[model samples]
Target: MELPVVKYNRSHYIETDTGNKVSRKSVIYGSQNITLSGKTIIQAGCVIRGDLRRAGGGQTLVIAIGRYCLLGENSVIRPPHKTYKGVFSYYPMKIGDYVAIGENSIVEAANIGNHVQIGKNCIIGRFAIIKDGCRIEDHTVIAPNTVIPSFSVYSGSPGRLVGELPECAPEMYEARSKEFYSKFMAT
Candidate 1:
C-alpha cells in the first residue's frame, strides 16, 4: 500500500538545525503522537510513523533526540516496543545528548548514550546498548541484541568492541558536537 502524504503547515520546507532539509514531499505522521525537541536534523525522504495498530490510541511515540543530533537523509526511527500478539504498543526511543547518525541508517535500539557517532548505512540491532563516547564506523553492521559499553569504538559485522574512543574526554566530545552544529547545521 502507498503511504499517505502529509503537508507541512508551518513552513515550505523542513530545515533542521544541522542544515539538513527534509523535502516537503516526505511523509510525517503522528504529529500529535510524536514529539520533537531540542536542535535536531532529519533529512529528506524519511518517514516518521507512530503506533500502527491503534489509530486512536492516546499514547504518542516518544523519540527523544537530545541536543545536536543529526539523523542523515532517508533514515527511519520507530519506537522501541514492537507490535506482537496482533496488538500495537508504544515504546520510547531514548537518545541522549550530542549524537550523530549517518545516512540511510536504521536505529531501533535503546539508549544511545551521549557523544556517540553511528556511521552511514549501518544497522543498529535491537536491545543493543551503545554507551557514551562511542564511535561506530561507516558500513558497520551491529548485530542484533549486542551490547556496547561506554567510551568504546565497535566496527565489525557483529560489532566487536575495538577500544576506547580517541577523544573520550567530555571536553572533546563537546567540541566535536559544536563543530557538527556549525559546519553542517549552519548551512
Candidate 2:
C-alpha cells in the first residue's frame, strides 16, 4: 500500500520528502534544512526552525531527527541562537531512534539516547546528556551540561536521580516504542 503525500511551502535550500507526514499547521521556514525518513510525523503546531540566526539571513541550521521518533504536540527542537549567550553554540540536538518527547518540552541539548521518554513541560538544557532507557518525568528540569547515564529514572525540578525504575520503566518505554513503530512508523 502506497502512503498519502503532503507538501508545504519552504524557502530556498530546504528539502522535505513525501516520506514524512507533516501537518498543514506546522510552520517550517524555507531557510532551514531538514532530512526526515521512515514514518516521521511533524504534528500540528510543531515548529522546527532550521534557521538559527534570530536576525535572519544566515547559514541554515541543520536538524536531523532519526527514524521511529515521536515529537509530541508543540515540542520545539532547534539549535540555540546567539541572542541567548547562555545557550550559544548548542547545536545538533541529536535524538536517537524510538524516542518520545512530550508536549511543550524544550530541548536545546547535545544528545538524547534511544528509547528515552521525556515528559511534558520538561526542560532539557544545553549539553545535557540523557542516556539510553531513561525516563524523564513531567515538569522535570535537567540542568545544563549534566550527564544522565543509561538506565535511570529522572524526575523533579532541577532533575536528579531518584532511583532505578524497578526494572519496569525501561520495559514500558520499549513497549511505547513498539507502539509508535506500529501506529506511526511502517504505515
Top TM-score prediction, candidate number: 1
- Give candidate 2 regions above 4 Å deviation: 1-19, 30-32, 53-61, 81-90, 166-172, 184-187
RMSD of each: 7.7, 6.6
Candidate 2 worst ten-residue window by lDDT: 6-15
What C-alpha lDDT, on a 0 to 100 scale, does residue 115 get in candidate 2?
Answer: 73
lDDT of 1 at 65: 69
- Clashes per candidate (backbone, < 3 Å): 1, 1
Error of 1 at 24 (Å): 3.4
Worst 10 residues of 1 by lDDT: 1-10
For 1-187, candidate 1 gives per-residue lDDT tens digits of 2223333333545675644445575566665665555566565666666543244535655666677776777777665555668876645667777787888888877678888888988888765678888888887888766778877877877677776866545557666666655544222
TM-score of 2: 0.73
Best candidate (score: lDDT):
2
| lDDT values for all models | 0.67, 0.69
